[model samples]
Target chain A: MTRRASMAASLVGFGVSVAAIFLLPSVLELFTLINATIYVSMAILALSLALIWGYGGILCFGQAAFFGLGGYTYAVAAINFGDSTWAVVLAMVVPALFAALLGYFMFWGRIGDVYLGVITLTMTLIFFKLFNATAGDAYKIGKAALGGFNGIPSTPPLNLPWDVGSPLAPEDIWYIAASLLVLLYFGSRWLLRTSFGRVVVSIRENERRSELLGYDVRRYKLGIFTIGGAMAGISGILFANCVFVSPTMFSLFYSAQVIIWVTVGGIGTLLGPIIGAIALQMIVAKLGTLEVIDPNVVLGSILLLFVLLVPKGLLPLMQSGFDRLRRPKAPVPVEPAIRPTATPAARRPEPVSAPVGSAPATNTLGGS
Target chain B: MDLAVVVLLQVIAAVASLVLISIGLAVIFGMMRVINLAHGEFIMLGAYAVIYATRWGVNLWVAMLVVAPIVVGLIGVVVERTVIRFLYGRMIDTMLATWGLSLLLIGAATMIFGNVTAGVSAPLGGVTIGEYQTSLYELVIVAIVTAVVLALMAVLRFTQAGLIARATMQNPAMAASLGIDTSKVYAVTFGAGAALSGLAGALISPLSGVVPTMGVAYVAKAFITVISGGAAIITGTLSASTLLGSLNTLATFVATPVIGEVTLLFAAIVLLRILPQGITGKFFRRAL
Candidate 1:
């Protein structure tokens, strides 16, 4: 199915973006607005997996490795530099570099699919173990100390640009986070709309076919993996700004939660992960307050119920339901039939990777 | 010289436990291609089963040998029918669902067992080698692990049931056409895997003690061993466990537990880079 949203979807997305960035703060309570920042940051984490798993077809189980690295990088850099700006940039760069390095081993070595999952999963656990062992004065990286289980609590908050004297208020931080999420939602949608995005998605659908068509599938996979890592890093920076950087960031629980958000939010759509992360985090957080039930039991049950009943997830289910009400004259197969019945022989000759203008498979692959 | 003997025992103990914990996960992944994220929890369930059974007047050996696998095997069957049956071939979904199952198991254990409890101790006493001393249980464990691997290989190689399982895994459609029930095979294989994990848990409880969250310590190591083992499940598990378990024990002996873990991960990265499909993927391709 084409991932591109229709004109109406674009319009609705714009409205949602405006509402989230410009309107939601006024309506939400002070407590919830602060919590919403965490949710927004987590939504980015969910989106990172969505890009990798949903579109790139790479189910990276160690996303939190990059994420925790982002937090720790920011905490360490921020402490050392006495400014959050460079730390924020370093947070994104460090994780991307790490992913690139790790991805180099896996992809260049032809480690794809399920094996990739195990390696990445093990990598995250390794980070958790390594970080947790970093106790005492011996583990400090410059001015910042790796506090082992008790993560760096003294992490500097993001200041107004380079003005380290003035830190952003929680309200201001919320503004930046909420707006950054909106900008990123559009950015992700834009990235998918680009030639690069379609090629990545096509590779996900059929790697061998894409390779036969002359695209270096390994490079595309690595590129997407790196981008996902950087996106996760940004989320880490935002997360550390609110909560202190800790080893728990690299824990399996966070790793699972990001995948859960993407699954629940619905894969193949940016908005789905955002919605899923916020809703589930709110549910689990609310449940955490109640002493009666362990939040994990409820979380696990909900995930189980969702996977069994709605494996396609909430977004696609809702879209189909909406499509049913809107289109009485046709079925779901009509959308895919937009592409020509066969590849035009005249257009099949040269420039195998150009993704030339207006050709169904090559150009605007997901054009709605 | 005694230190060398002690280190050798450590490496053997490490490799044996790695095999014990990972064999079931290897079976499930090898046969069905289903990554049971809750494989570690299945181990936990087995340990708990032993503890409960022993508390209910069953002999410790009976609890460990028979009750653990039976209890967990049945649970695995139930899991397959309810959750896993629908998720065949969907690897990522299976991982997430089983991960959720693990969370439920951990939470349930925490609620029921109150997070901590007294566990059964190893039966044997210490054995000394010159200046160094070690647990005699470690030797027994190594012996038992070897027997378990041998029995598993024998079953898969010699039995009619093993042949049917092999055929079904090779081509479920063909097996079904041949009038064999593939789904039943899948269920049985998954149960067997869980049973093995349960047995591993029971075996390990004496060394590590039983806790709700103990599975977290095992599942990653098991996954690494199984995945690094590659297409050949039995031999792969053996080879990967020996290589990895030795590196881990040797590093821990030289440095610390954390360094040992880092060494294992580093070794896995190098192994996968060198042999992406794993050890069995490159060699012993035909052997089950």
Candidate 2:
């Protein structure tokens, strides 16, 4: 608990993470390295979900809308912007701006959970249909060509002018991806530790409480939503470089997959989602290679099992098991509130007005 | 006059299909808090069931009647008891869980059905109405949709069981306090929703080709219809679908079909911006 000891532990953990990133390919079997890189990208995407759902308390069903936008933006920019670092930056910024504008309307309007999810889903569908529609020879945006349904092909790989070797290879790309992942992971963690991040979490737990505490909750929510969208855009930039960006990348199914990664890992935990993405993708990919039986059947069964048995996700399940093993003989306190009772109308619904940390739930745009 | 007749028939056909899909979706949403993204999968499965059953020498109508509801209903029960039961109160998780179920169903169907488009012959053949050639199957679809709508309205309006379902949906704890078994209500609602989905699938299997990925296409439209319809039963869904479908149909006629679809999306977005409660919700409020 000493500052020196804490710093040492932190340094050690950082070293271990970096080592795992570099050495995971050699230690694991069957494209684990490539898989890890992709999962890292997915984790970036999942982080956006965490920021929105876990912290902001907004369940956006269409994070893939931003992801797809990021991907298309990156692909289009990389193709047009002459293989420079500026192209990648532009790709990230364009989508970030787009997300900020969308989030402004949604958050400012005071959309509730179900309505928020619907709006986001609809936005993604609109993007999908639009992308599909504009995919023609005549359609052109800057130097980038919109290929419609058949997406832009032959997108240039990452171009690091100062790198000593060929940056186009998977290994080089992996290094770049690994570096960016570290930066983003730490950057996000640091962001959450800041006042803004605290406000975001407060917003998630109770908007009304936060509002009453005199914080501008709407502005904070919009701010975080936009940041998450930007982070997703960053992931999209990486994704476009890793694989060919297509309109299908923006599909609801793809958005659903991002949620699955976050859920399977554990929402609210920083590392849980990345781990979930890596593990689930490996399982799906392996199952897909199996003969006779369908991978989708396996996926469905697993999803059902997870949702039923391990609702908080694999991380929480593992954590609980670890805790139990660490302290086995302690008496478990029974929660009287959760006890099952037949025809149970005894308990009253607790009026949770808002999370207690900061601000009240005030939709400022209502006045507008 | 000929062009007008063609447009009318097209509108009728589109309305029949739209009504079938929208009503089922509306009912499911009304009963269960679950916005079943996989509802389309049930429809797809029913279509496949009819396709396979017809191939096995069963009469098309009999196969459609027997296979659709049962197949989708059984899947619904399994889904409700297993995955969806846990996902209550968590909208994002519900969406994700249903989506996973959808992917599995679509993928499994692809593996089994080989991703080929297949169709079933309608029970009634083509009919000539005056100078126009109209399919009797289309007329049957329209009639069936109408009958189903009327039956649904009656059940929701008059039946004690329907009242319980509505009560449970509006307030689960209150309904339970009033002696309704909320768990049973939830299960029944889920089953009924699945059955409607299957029914829609069976009805439209002949009109649209049956394929694994077909459900994905319908998923957005169904959700859009429900949202546009204002989360109510019968009237909202029917009116929204008709309005949107007509817009879509007319847009296609006036411009390139792609532009029409885009225009519809644009209109919906604009409408969503203007009236978040949706068209049906606004109208119902004013009418009352």
Number of the top candidate by DockQ? 1
lDDT of each: 0.84, 0.72
Question: In model 2, where do residues sit more than 4 Å from their true spots?
Answer: A1-10, A24-35, A161-167, A329-368, B82-92, B111-114, B122-136, B171-174, B286-288
Tell me the tens digit of each residue's lDDT in model 1 across A261-331. Answer: 87777766667788899899999898878867778788787788777787657876776666657666654
Error of 1 at A265 (Å): 1.5
For model 2, residues A1-368, the per-residue Cα lDDT tens digits are 23454357557868997897778666765455666677778878887786676556677778988888888877777667666476677767877788788777777777666666777887888888888887666888887888888778776777776342444666666767777777776777777767788777766656788899999888998888888888888888777777777788888777878777766676665566767776788787877777567777777667656655665576655655654575578543221111111011111122334333211222110000
Model 2: per-residue Cα lDDT at residue A203: 67
DockQ versus reference, model 1: 0.50
DockQ-derived CAPRI band for the predicted complex in model 2: acceptable
- Candidate 1, which segments miss by more than 4 Å at Cα? A1-5, A23-29, A332-368
lDDT of 2 by residue, B95-155 (tens): 6678778878887888889878898766677876567787888888888888878887788
Clashes of 1: 0
Question: What does the lDDT come to for candidate 2?
Answer: 0.72
